[model samples]
Target: MRAAPARRGRDGADTRARIEAVALELFAQKGVAGTSVRDIALGVGVSEGALYRHFPSKEKLSRELFLTRYATLAAEICAIDAAERELERKLRAVVGLACALFDAEPALFAYLLIHQHEHLGLVPEAPEANVVEAVAQMLRGAGVPPGRVTLASAMALGCVVQPAVFALYGRIKGPLAAQADDIAAAVMVVVEGQARG
Candidate 1:
């Protein structure tokens, strides 16, 4: 029997990973509309056609990148919400996780953070894969009224997200994790104040 032809390295899983990493960096640096398929192909040292084999279009790649990573983070938050009893502890854990992710994977985290509005509407409302819904569940578990959960969740999430945004822009210095406690506290204020009102 004839030996099977070897698979090209550039057409393998490693190439897909490289394409995603480079696409993320480019998308974060230059808005999704600004980063072209050619830019990603060049960054990955592959032909544009090769990148297409991995992702049919830049929009599809961006969508997959945003949805998957966002779902990962949302699932983690849902896990924390499930494990922690109190709102305070859950907020702390969520804030800490966000900061740690931002510090550890700035490009991936920044891409998710900066481009949320562009893709968030496409995200399902399931708490297991939606951070806002997950946080709202936490608030509701703590006795926040149904009417206020959405606004409260948004406010509390902003406590962590805004600082990350500031850090991304260089307005804030040092590791984002360094400010986790303060951010978590601010989140509590939002939750507690919402509960009171």
Candidate 2:
């Protein structure tokens, strides 16, 4: 028996998403500079022309993919109402969220870290800054001094995120799950210090 035909709009979106996913996987595995549009098209089971129809150029596609992921993360982070939580709780939540995201996409995390310098301009500076700002705001709301908030945020990024990034990139050898938890705990200490002082 023949299968039903795909509906236009939803099927089109699904196909695009599949292409993007395959492209991201290839790029992560081979490095964006090493991967080709033909490679992405082959992985997605589509013609090169079709890939071009969806993404004009490989660089443009890469930028769009990164931006799309970052936007989704930013939205998730923004959705957390830090105003309702204590500073320590809010900071913990942020670290937890980051860990969860990294766990869900370790390859993507590795790719980002590997290419961070090359794509520094494409990085969503605002989204990251927003996360720091949210932490600072939460600390202020909890009656912590502004100076402490900045220091806490810096420490959290350095201790939690930097190490997690390294872990994802395989620069350090260990279980990522355990490392993520430890990083979150370390970040919480910094937050707690800010809350108490």
**Predicted model with the maximum lDDT:** 1
Q: In model 1, where do residues sit more than 4 Å from their true spots?
A: 1-11
**Backbone steric clashes in candidate 2, count:** 0
Cα TM-score per model = 0.92, 0.76
Specify the poorest-scoring 10-residue window by lDDT in model 2: 123-132
For model 2, state the Cα shift of residue 18 in Å: 1.2
Candidate with the greatest TM-score versus the true structure: 1
Weakest ten-residue segment in model 1 by summed lDDT: 1-10
lDDT of 1 by residue, 72-121 (tens): 88899999988998778888999999999999989998899889888999
Assess the local accuracy of residue 164 in candidate 1 as a C-alpha lDDT between 0 and 100. Answer: 91
Name the lDDT value of residue 130 in candidate 1: 86
Q: Residue 88's C-alpha lDDT in candidate 2? A: 53
Reference-based lDDT, each prediction: 0.90, 0.69
